[model samples]
Target chain A: MTRIVFLGWLKEMAGCAERQVELPSLATPEELIAFVAGDNQSLAEQLAEPSIRMIINKSVLAGKTLPDTIEEVAFMPPLSGG
Target chain B: MIKVQSDIFDPGAELNNFMQGRTDMGAVVSFTGHVRGQNDISALELEHYAEYTETEIGKIEIQAQRRWPGIHTHIIHRYGKMKPGEPIVFVAVCSAHRQDSFRAATFLMDSLKTRAPFWKKEISGDKGVWIEPKASDYAAEKQWTNKV
Candidate 1:
């Protein structure tokens, strides 16, 4: 099972901050996002935003496919830190 | 030193402590960011990924140190709910010359603004609005690469 975390407005849209789920085979960020968003179109639309960032195992996931032994995946909206 | 805390801190005291016993360093530069009390905003709510936020900022601090050797840097950023006018972030750098100290501090702030994982929401009365970084903020960060 992969731990999925959401931040910023995505948290609100997702309705929860975190969850654990089993991913499908060769799950990329797009597939992971689709799986997480499920049938909620609003949440899916928000998650589909281009600026959303994906972090896996404490580092930004730049590649297309998630590693097989992933621990955590975080979906972060654009940062606006001081 | 890097600190990510929910408790309020005295920036002046932090700076004083960071500057203490640094006789070898000729220049010390510091910046403190406060929550703006404007547009009827009552408070700013900052959310951060507990460990990842610090880890990312630590990477930035490391980069700044590597970019400007012989420099001491400190970053203190607050998360959670804070009232307007309350201190939000503080950065300080000490070096043998003013240019490195100043530029390092600026780099830290710019990186913190654009790269750090902290998210901000402006709270005004019953409404809370998530905010994105301004175009100017991206431009400021891009200055490091001469992209602007």
Candidate 2:
């Protein structure tokens, strides 16, 4: 099971701030994005935006590998604070 | 120190508290950011990740400390809804010299603008627009590297 978090406009598009998904197999960040988007075309497009950031387990997701014990994953739009 | 909260804070009072009994530190620099009312913006809402916002800011604070040793820092960032002209964030740094205090304050603010996880939405009437960091902000943060 993996916890997915959506921030900014993505939360409105996803209709929820966070959700849980049980992956059929260990999936990379890209595959996880594809799976999460599923049939939601709008979500898929937003997720594909280059400015969007992916953070896994509280850190920016780096490299391509997704471990089996992965926990939380967050999708965030460009940050504008301070 | 780092604080992310919804309550409105008085930057002057916070600075006073931070400066209390700190005569040994020769210089203290502080910055306060306010919500802008451009394009008739009525309110601004700041969204943040409850779990990672402070930790990320803490990381930047640590970096600033490492970059300029013997400096003390305090950061207060407000989240949730705020009206135009209301204070949104406050950063204060103290050091033995003017250069370190000034540079550390600027570095902390620049990092907060680019590296922090807070997103802002400008509310105008019934419409709200999410804002992205400007190219200048990124460029500002980039200037803190070894080349400088």
Candidate 3:
């Protein structure tokens, strides 16, 4: 189980801020994207864009590496100023 | 002092409160950000996560204090509906000299715009649009990574 977090309009669109997803061991980020896409079409469409950022444990992850534990993962839209 | 409020702020009173009991400081620099009436197409509606926004701003203030030792810092960000000419945010820094206070205040506002978790919705003629961070803001924030 991995904790996935969403923010801003994405959270409103998804209807929740956090969720727990149970996935097979050693699943890549691509696989995670597929899993999310299957569950939430709006999220899937947003994630399909290249500009969106994926962060794991506060560090930006660019490669495909699955976490061994259910750590917190954040899916953030492009940030805006106040 | 750090504050996130929906009401308008009196810059004069706020500065006095922040400067009280600070005889050691010689210079104070402050920046007040205002809501622009035109958001490319029309007006903008600002929204934020109350708890998270305050926490993030607190962290920024702490970081500023650490960077400039013995300096006083204050950050105030207003949430919800704000009109043009209204102050949206305030960042003030005080130090022994003008250079340190000036630079720190600028850095705080620049970083806050990029790292802070605030969203804006622009309302135009019969349409509304959400504003996203510009490439320039990202570039500005990236420059600080090496300094930190």
lDDT of 3 at A28: 78
> lDDT, candidate 2, residue A21?
88
Query: Which of 1 and 2 is the better model by DockQ?
Result: 1
Give per-residue CA lDDT, model 3, range A1-82, as digits (tens): 6777776667777678778887565487777777765778767878767777776765567777765664767777776865
Ranking by lDDT: 2, 1, 3
Candidate 2 residues A1-82, lDDT tens each? 7899999879999999999988667567778788888899889888978888888889887778886676888998988999
Models 1 onward score TM values of: 0.96, 0.96, 0.77
lDDT of 3: 0.77
lDDT of 2 at B11: 93
Best prediction by lDDT: 2
**On a 0 to 100 scale, what is the lDDT of residue B81 in model 3?**
68
Docking class of 2: high
TM-score of 1: 0.96
Model 1 agreement with the true structure over A37-61: per-residue lDDT tens digits? 9998888788777888888888888
**Residue-level lDDT tens digits of model 2 in B97-118:** 9999999999999999998899
Q: After superposition, how far is residue A61 of candidate 1 from its true place, in Å?
A: 1.0
